[model samples]
Target: MDRLHRQVGAVGLAAAAVLPGLSAQVDQHAAEVRDLLGVRGRRPTLTALASYTDGLLDGATGRGWQPPQHDLVGWAGADGVAVRLLALCALVTSAVA
Candidate 1:
């Protein structure tokens, strides 16, 4: 869990920095992550991760991305649950990139 957490945080930071062009995709990925968090089970986590991966793939192959609006450090620190989901987002972005 610790390893996964750290990896997610690190990748999330990178994703937030470099994947802004994929903002629309990121939005869906973020939503999925948030929704998954509402449930309790490993399956939900896996599903959210899968959705994020799909979003990243779509983002990469779709079109141009915009610049990210928030600073990585500041954004992640803003809210607890959000931060976690974003961390997972970061991981997915990095993995796909």
Candidate 2:
């Protein structure tokens, strides 16, 4: 495999590894957010996290998101809550770094 392929494989593996944990965190966050906002089941937390994390990994490795979603904020948004948390982590890390 090429360098890019290896890196991609690694990122995919890392994302997969943390997916469950990230989903759990996102679920917690979503629950709180929803409760605060007085909404129910409003966010597709797990899927969004995975999608966002994938997007971040791609961005960090100099690859753009492929087949980007038409709507990433709402119901038709990205998949996997782990991905979403990755993006959030990136944003926070960048802000603090």
Which structure among the candidates has the greatest TM-score?
1
| Candidate 1 displacement at residue 12 in angstroms | 3.6
- Summarize candidate 2's per-residue lDDT along 1-97 as a digit string, tens digits: 2232233323433453456654454446445544644445544343443454455557754644442222222212334433443334433322344
**Candidate 1 segments whose C-alpha is farther than 4 A from its true place:** 36-97
Model 2 CA deviation exceeding 4 Å by range: 1-18, 41-97
Clashes of each: 4, 18
Looking at candidate 2, the ten consecutive residues that score lowest on lDDT are 67-76
Q: Which candidate number would show the highest lDDT if scored against the true structure?
A: 1
lDDT by residue for model 1 (40-81), tens? 322345555766545654664376532234445444433334
Q: Please list the Cα RMSD from the true structure of every candidate, rounded to 1 decimal place.
A: 10.0, 14.5
Local accuracy by lDDT, each model: 0.49, 0.41
Error of 2 at 93 (Å): 22
Model 2: lDDT of residue 54: 55
